[model samples]
Target: RRTVRAIAVACMLTSATTAVGLASLVVSKTVMLRHFGLTSGLGVMVSYVVIITFVPAVLTWVTPPKREEVRRERTSMFTKVSNGLVARLLRWRWAVLVATDLFTVGAGYVASGITVDHALLDQFDETDPVYTTTLLIEEKLAGVRPLEVVLVSTEEDHFMDPEMVQTIQKIRNWAALRPEIIRTSSYGDMLRESYVLLSGDPSVRSENFKSAKQVKGLVTMMSQRDPSPLNDWLTQDGKKARVQFKLRDVGAQATMRFLDALEQEIESELGDDETVSVSFTGEAYTASRGQAAVVNDLLGSLLVAVVVIFLLLAFFFRSVRLGLLSIPPNLIPLVATMAYMVWREIPLNVSTVIIFSISLGLAVNGTIHVLARFREEMHTGIGREAALVRAARGTGRAIVISCVTLMAGFSVLLLSSFVPVRNFGELIAITIGGCLVATLLVLPPLLSVAGGDGGVRDSSD
Candidate 1:
């Protein structure tokens, strides 16, 4: 009965702590993450209700009391092993502390190397149809992605002004010459083709328009022809012109860099042109900005989660030291998971980055359960060492069982076809396993040494 009550209390506390971290993701700008956060938070609440209410009710109704006692005694081997391990750990607590510090330092070093990956193409396997099709398009057609440069004129038909036309032509020429650019097209191309046709000389180019009147005449003549495509490139008022730069399918970071450099060049070439201004918009630009937003949200969510969990622990235990002790066990799993990513050269993307908050929330469960049992044992008038051993024996098996169940649940994600989803599942499983080890092995000794009287009996007593 005592063990069952302790388990119920611990499970409820674990659910609350985990929900705090998951709830923080509700503020993310990404729609997918927002949905994930809400669903996961609800799932935690539902699981807690079921574990506390349904499981206990079923045990009470179906299982006889005498059989329950016999079953518990049959599990005595696990308790004995746990008690022996905790006894050994408490005796060598200093060595354990040193080893933990060294491991944490190494993990922290590796974690520092983790980087955000902005590439959309890298999300899938090379043999994926999307990947192969994109490659084929880059090789055969005008690239798969378009980087648009919109040139705005201060007045109507200003696109016909010789200086404006020259600036547009220069920008197009610059883009066309770049190896990364597969092709370039604009109203400038149409103007050049019309000029050659009108002059009856293939050598004549559109830049040959020496005066504003000539440029206007060329635009007027083209307007007479079917202008559906022309309307897309030029605004109805002729006040805006767009140059479409078809770029080879470069990854997100490289694409952003290219756009930045091109914008700078446009500024330098069209210096102080009060009549014209330029801006950029395209699929590549949107994706780059989205990646940045995700990174910011990830960092913010992590900070909020840590603060919330810390406060919750403090409030639950009514002891600041116990609350502080909760941090290292939870953090070890998160940091070690990131270190594993660094060692494996995995880039932190939209899906993988959320693992930090999720792991933090889940990892603290074992720590809370162990601490709750330790406090219960101390309240029975036992010495600190005996309480620690008893707590480990009574609670350690439950923590291990819970962690294994959670890991198995998350591990099912490995079957997902998406690489990010698979990686998320694998990393989360590792994180739960790491948390189990930290909670069972590392946390008990720390509590024995630092947690004086196990927060039950005062020193004056």
Candidate 2:
């Protein structure tokens, strides 16, 4: 019965794992859900469900269970069962493995923090023809980070008045103080700062329009057209003036800070008055703030997942200690991923935030399986030592297999055309790998020290 039960459990788990893997492939292929509208959280949740539900159900009916072995004795059976596996795992040198992983995760944190963000354009290598062409085009053309600030007046005709024109010029001068502000241009700046030079005397400035006499001759000689063309940028009613500025190679965090400061400066210059006001509209600014909002959402979802997992563990084990203990190992991969991001110079964009949250649930899944098996063994009246061995022996292969299934599921994402999704997949792959290591190496040692050979219910206390 014991042998049959183990086989049944393993088969059930494998099938479920396979289904989830396949579901990930199908769901990931869908365009609107994967890329445009849904948040990464919603997408990952859907993908995870698709995998978990179908695979196990199909496999359970199809595959036969492993042959059952009758137990000759229950006392030393657990030890004998896990002996070979434990020895094999220990052969890898746990101390060295732990030390290396700790150092690597730590170093990644430091490196990621120190590295500057390379612009999106720079991400493609020079060897790529597209990158080369883009670089050449960028040099000859204007910048890519599009931003604009429109200053509007209560009355349209007021925008064309000299008072409004000077106000716009002063705002441009104030904005020039920020290094991130590359350049500012407006109709007002041209009229206020630029002027006609006398035909005979280059050194002299015209004191009056009449002194220049021939406005037509002056316009014709300068190879310039009437400033009236600038009206296209102004509001139809002539109540608003716009000053445009572009940023170079700025990440979401930097963009947010810049906007915050710019808002304050705009408010200081153009207060809550009835005559004038400033409003900003652009993809760059909106996306930056949106990315930050997504980060907060990811954090919230992870917190909820943690709580749910904790409650489930506590209720299932009837032990708060075990429940609390499970939470930290789950967090290991998250912290490590963050440290990796900090190291790799990857931005916490929309894609990565979703992967990071979903990864928490995934990393904990294997641990839950192992713990569940361990509890089952103990409940069956096996001794703590025997139960611990039974738990390890029974669940090790399933845990390893589950990790394989997850890796296979996430691999499809590597083929994504979207850069953000690709980055997300890579980070998730790392988290999955890290979790596997934690379960196989860290969990075993931790279980040993924590006395998984179940004594009293609360080990920590």
Candidate 3:
């Protein structure tokens, strides 16, 4: 009962802060992130209720450990180190703060340079069978990804017109020059090839046909493949034409550049008229678009988490300055990890960008635990230095032990064959390590700077 009472306020504070951080995800534009935020936030609150209610009732049936055993634990190496750490930190508060500020500013600068991108094969390692087989398929198949440019016109039988046929050839020629596009095929290009073959005149072309009826004759005379008919590229009534291009194995940034350039070339061919509306659609194109949304949604989530957590901390401590102090310990871990990711060339992708939310929630939980203990100790009329030392020893062992256990749990992700998952695990482990050090070394000295005079002075002085 004493133990539970001692931790009850801190426990509630941790749960409230964690749940609020997760609740910010409700504003995410992506459905997956929204659901993740909702369910996970609810889960955190539910667990908090269970811990406070169920554990206390069960404790009545359990036996307490001997006082001697508890005393021995307090004298252990972790406890001794935690006390020694604060003793040294209280001696050089401003120096520690300056060093931490310098590191965070440098890290933030480097992290700002990270480019948002998407790559289909980036999930797998190069030596993996999935990756190797995909490369072989791209080699033999003239590229496996499809990007379709659908052209629509209000005019009936528009695609069969000679002017439209010439326009398509210009677009095809543009596509052929792009290294990202391995092959370009469409109804007009195929008909043009067939016209040159059948007419026995080297001057014959799709534009030479000059009429819809003449173009239809060439389409009818062409030998249809066993599966897809040539009409697939040309819709009935001839109002729309599907120009399919097989895209090369390229990253999202390269694909986006190609798409942007293609849009310009298309405008140059068709001119500023709604007569023919062009749109890009297909597997590769849709994935590229979705990657952009992921970057936007995750960055929004990160902002929301920060704001909600700051408010929650201020409310818990009942002081704005205490709330403001929480920012450095929590924010710096994310900054340092992101800087490490930039150095390692890890792009913000599906699995990796989530590191901020997970690590920040955890960082807040640990930091608040120590801060809560410091407040409790000060309430007993001890000086700031003495209170800090007591809080460090009181909460340090559990915080370090919990963080080490989490690091081990996350390390399991490193065993995954998927590269993104492995990187996520690796970066998360680094962040947790950062959080542990910050909670012990950085946060305590910074708290001493907060103006609060307890009734007693430090005995060591």
Q: Which stretches of candidate 3 lie over 4 Å from their true place?
A: 200-213, 219-228, 451-461
- Which 10-residue window of candidate 2 scores lowest in summed lDDT? 18-27
The digit string of per-residue lDDT tens for model 2 on 1-461 reads 44444444434333333233223322332354234323543455555566556655676677554444323323245545455555544444457457646866785566456322234553455576766665554455545666788777777466555445555667777777777666667765444324532344533332333322233333233335565545545654567667787665466667778888888877776665667777887765766766666556555555655666677566655677667766656677777777788777676654566665467656677777766676677667776556656677767766778888888788788787656666777888888888887776665545554535442455335
RMSD of each: 2.8, 7.4, 3.9
Is candidate 2 or 3 superior in lDDT?
A: 3
The weakest ten consecutive residues by lDDT in model 1 span 452-461
lDDT of 3 at 261: 90
Candidates 1 and 2 compared by lDDT, better number: 1
- Runs of candidate 1 with Cα error greater than 4 angstroms are 1-4, 64-77, 177-179, 206-208, 457-461
Candidate rank order under TM-score: 3, 1, 2
Please count the clashing residue pairs in each candidate, in the order shown.
0, 9, 0
Runs in model 2 deviating more than 4 A are: 1-119, 126-137, 155-157, 173-183, 189-232, 264-274, 316-319, 408-421, 445-461
lDDT of model 3, residue 295: 74
Find the 10 residues in a row with the least total lDDT in model 3: 451-460
Q: Model 2 clash pairs? A: 15-55, 15-56, 16-56, 19-55, 20-51, 112-342, 112-343, 156-238, 156-239
Q: Rate the local accuracy (lDDT) of all candidates.
A: 0.81, 0.60, 0.82
TM-scores of all candidate predictions against the true structure: 0.90, 0.68, 0.91
